[model samples]
Target: MSLQSSNDGPLDFVKYQNVVDGKLVASSNGETYHNINPSTLETNPEVPLSASDDVDKAVIAAQKAAESWAKVPWDERKKRLMDFADALEAHTEAFSQMLVKGNGRPPLHQKIIYDKLI
Candidate 1:
């Protein structure tokens, strides 16, 4: 199935990866799992299969950031959340398509969910 972004025309093919500590990281074991396209039943490139080590790193990173995150002013935190909402709105279509491709959900259903959640 073809996926297109209204503003960007055809969607560019992208390889998925794991994000850890705000950075894209490969699994320590170099293991990956295929992300199968639901519609086409085609497998995309392998994405990182995060092992226990990766989870440990992620937890440690979150723990380290907890103090600063907790110290942020309420208003600033609200503003940051609003900014994030705006960013999600700007990319709604793209994100919806990603849901379809990644989760094999119908675009309409995904859009509905996005509308409610985002």
Candidate 2:
């Protein structure tokens, strides 16, 4: 039910949903697919199998947000981008472990890559 990474600690069970309109939502038909951990060959989470309807809804949401996003000031946009980068840097270890688990890569390899990037 959950993904466990030795380096990152335990991840609680979660149902991965499609992000539509900045909200987590299931597929229109409630279809799901297993997110299997490659190393352990275990299902950690279930992600939505989005259909055409879900794609349409997501496209609409993006179209609606595009105008406002484009109007944002350059400074504010840069700040937001920096903030996102900072957050990712802060969680590099956890993310590296996740990459290892999901892709069946050696933990050391992932850690090295994360170190180089972050």
Candidate 3:
């Protein structure tokens, strides 16, 4: 099954952006590496290996965000976390499918991840 977006072109399904703070960003060096599946030996060509600079940027962003995000009330944080949990539960099927495709894991195994988060 393909993930289609009307406005955007077809997903490259290759490159994965680095998660900086909470947003995805490209590598500074524009360098990328391939990840091979041990079982099938199928190489995923599009996944960009994040550069070290991305890690530094992500850490800085998280530090900045944490300063403000931590100031919020504990109750509010708990509520938001719970909401996120609920959203994950509601989107279990889609989440599992994405996980299986990216991770090359069986659907049954993906349930373990969701269970662990719960």
**For this target, which candidate reaches the highest lDDT against the unseen true structure?**
1
Q: What is the clash count of model 3? A: 3
Task: Give the Cα-based TM-score of candidate 3 against the true structure.
Answer: 0.69
The TM-scores of all predictions, comma-separated, are 0.81, 0.77, 0.69
What are the RMSD figures for all models against the true structure?
A: 5.9, 5.9, 5.5
86 Cα displacement, candidate 1 (Å): 0.9
**Per-residue lDDT for 1 in model 1?**
12
Clashing pairs in 2: none
Residue range 71-118, candidate 1, lDDT tens digits:
999999898788778767887887888778888888999999998998
lDDT of each: 0.77, 0.76, 0.68
- Ordered from best to worst TM-score, the candidate numbers read 1, 2, 3
Clashes of 2: 0
Q: What are the runs in model 2 whose C-alpha is more than 4 Å off? A: 1-13, 115-118
Clashes of each: 0, 0, 3
